[model samples]
Target: MKYIKLAAVVVAASISGCATILSEDVATVNVATSTGKKIDITIDGQNYTVPGVVKLEKDGQSKIISTNDADCASSTAMNRKVEGVFWVNLLSGGLFGSTTDSATDAMWTYDDYVTISCK
Candidate 1:
């Protein structure tokens, strides 16, 4: 029984990373406009309207948020940062778990909201 319990714990630790268990591969970000008017923005080459939500990958890459419309004021980028859960796992010496998170790109995250100034 003791050995079985130990094995179970090892299996769980190997399979579940802190970040992987707590985070997701996709994240939704809220896009809005300062003037509360609907503005068009481009992300990952796809167009979307402000005052909406966009689903983005949790990959560790910076995404360019831009506008083609002349009415919008400026563009911005969403930067990826390492998830805090991954650091916690690392600190806890969960090497396999942290490695799993890193391999699956679950260790990264982006801002939850973005606001663009529109004229």
Candidate 2:
């Protein structure tokens, strides 16, 4: 009975791993034009205004940032790797959680620390 209880506790604890708590499916990127102008911007086809922060989903999807400024160019970035917390989940026998997150696009996260200058 003691061993069974312990195993159950362990299993329950492993169900919600670090990946679920340490990361998210969205990323925020700061964007600006070369002239520090607030211009129209498109990220992954989503329309937004630059000189602002944009929140985007991360799931191995490549984000193409574009602008219409004559002196600037577009930029692209990709979320191609699973977050490190996913590995923590794997090591903790939380494969089910990790797999669930991946299937739900929750496990695929990227650093939300990027400044996308349109230049």
Model 1 segments beyond 4 Å from truth?
Answer: 1-5, 11-15
lDDT for model 2, on a 0 to 1 scale? 0.68
Which pairs of residues collide in model 2? none
Candidate 2 structure quality by residue, lDDT tens digits, 1-119: 99999999887776655666677657766655556766777877789987778888876665677767665665645445677778878877788777766676666655554445544
lDDT of 1 at 91: 89
Q: After superposition, how far is residue 70 of candidate 2 from its true place, in Å?
A: 1.5
Q: TM-score for all predictions?
A: 0.82, 0.67
Cα-based RMSD of candidate 2: 3.2
Q: For residues 1-119, write the lDDT of model 1, one tens digit per residue.
A: 99999999888877678899988789789988777888778888788877899998877788888987677766787888888899999888888899999998999988888778777
- Model 2 residue runs over 4 Å out of place are 1-18, 33-35, 117-119
Relative to the true structure, candidate 1 reaches a TM of 0.82
RMSD (CA, Å), each prediction: 2.2, 3.2
